[model samples]
Target: MKFKITHVTTYLFDSEVFLEPHYLRFRPCQTSYVDVSDFITTIHPQPVGHKIVQDEDNNVVEFCWFEGMTTQLTIRAESVLQTKSYNPFNFLIYPQSFNTLPFQYNDLQKKLLFSALEQLPISKGLIDYALSILKRSNFNTISYLTNLIKHLHDDFSVEYRAEGAPFMPEETFQLKRGSCRDLSWMLIGILRQQGIAARFASGYYYFDMIAPAYELHAWVDVYLPGTGWFDLDPSHGIFTGNTHFPLASSAHYQHTMPVSGGIRGSANSKLNTQLIIKKL
Candidate 1:
């Protein structure tokens, strides 16, 4: 499948205010299954300095700094991509003992998965929620992870909040509804509680029904000893494959923000965004 994507974001301020350096994480990292045929970006109020660099997580990002004041800032990017079908369950788990619940990672795996495995305090409700799913999966590692996303999808109301950090895991679980990021964060929490390493992923999901109108999507990426990093989209109740195009990822959700910066003055601002994904 092939896709063309355009994303535009604009901030209108009541008064001109100096713009600080901004970071943009809009470039998709090419993988074995996905190819970027072309990509370009345009920024209004051209910056005095601009450079592109790769972050620790291998995300190609743009850093821009401006010289003059402006009342509006707009960033637009377009990309052409071609993707191949991916089999999410094509791998085998090494070390048979690690295929069940309550299993431990080897020494090196633990060191590499340090941050991905870290978790805040877990409430009983969240634990019980995960345990209930495990009972149905009979504690099988692969089955448990797959079942978790389906339960979250069937049990929660997926809504759109346009902006804000995701709610804490406990909060989302209790509320029973949240945006894509909230669902991703909640899944991260549950994975950590079960001794699995998971991270936050932000990207675009190509759903035919939502064509020509869409929003950035968020999902979870968990690491298994043998299967490696795998994407599970709780919002969609399925494992991700060719339909998912990941732009950037981080153990923390804030780091995966598509656009982030600060303002120099106290000007009231309004934001508007436009996104369109089309099949060619």
Candidate 2:
């Protein structure tokens, strides 16, 4: 499938203000399954400087600095993408690892997955909650992971907040309701608690029912012993594949913000965004 994506964000301020260098993570990283082409970013109030660089996570980052004061700032990103049917389960079990969960990684793997395995302080409450879903004595690793995902999907209702930071894992667990980012973060914590190397992922979700439409979506990427990273979306209770296009995956969610910057002004501001993803 081929897709054309356009995302426009406009900020209206009551008074003119200087803008800081803005970081845009709108460009998708080229992968075996997805090819990105004809990408462009246009900024209103013309930026004085613009440069593109790759972050540590390999995401394409666009940096722009505005020189003059302006009352309105608009940023537009457009791209054409062609995606193939990437079977989530296509890879072989390299080095005879990743046949299942509870597997160990070699030295190279340890270095790469070091940060991902760093565990957070887990409360007894969380462990109890997790065990409630475990149920079976002979728990297969894959089955446990799958059940964990399905449990979150079926047990919680999503409360979509268009803006703001994600809720903490504890908050999401107690409330059982959160936005996509919140759920993804909580899932990462859960995976890490179980010694699974996981990270937060943000991207675009394309659905046929909403053709020509798109959404900023979040999910989790867990490291499979020999197969590398695989994406799993707790909100959808499925492995992300053809329908999901990842923009960034990092240990922190803030790292993948689509557009973020600071403006020096006391005036009130309003934001508006437009997104459209069309099949081509």
Candidate number with greatest TM-score: 1
What digit string (tens of lDDT, one per residue) describes model 2 on residues 1-280?
A: 8999898988899998999899888887787899997799889989999999887877888888988889999888898999987888676556564555556777887788887777766567876776666555234556677788888899878766788887878888889899999888888887788777898888888887734545688999888755678888999888888868888888778888888789887878998888888888
RMSD of 2: 2.1
Score residue 91 of candidate 1 by CA lDDT: 88
lDDT of 1 at 212: 54
lDDT of 2: 0.82
Error (Å) of candidate 1 at residue 33 is 1.2
Q: How accurate locally is residue 60 in candidate 1, as Cα lDDT from 0 to 100?
A: 90
State residue 258's C-alpha deviation in candidate 2, in Å.
0.8
TM-score of each: 0.96, 0.91
User: Candidate 1 lDDT (Cα, whole model)?
Assistant: 0.90
TM-score of 2: 0.91
Model 2 residue 59 lDDT? 80
User: Which residue runs does candidate 2 get wrong by more than 4 Å?
Assistant: 94-101, 132-137, 210-213
lDDT of 1 by residue, 43-91 (tens): 9989889999887777899999998899999999899999988899998
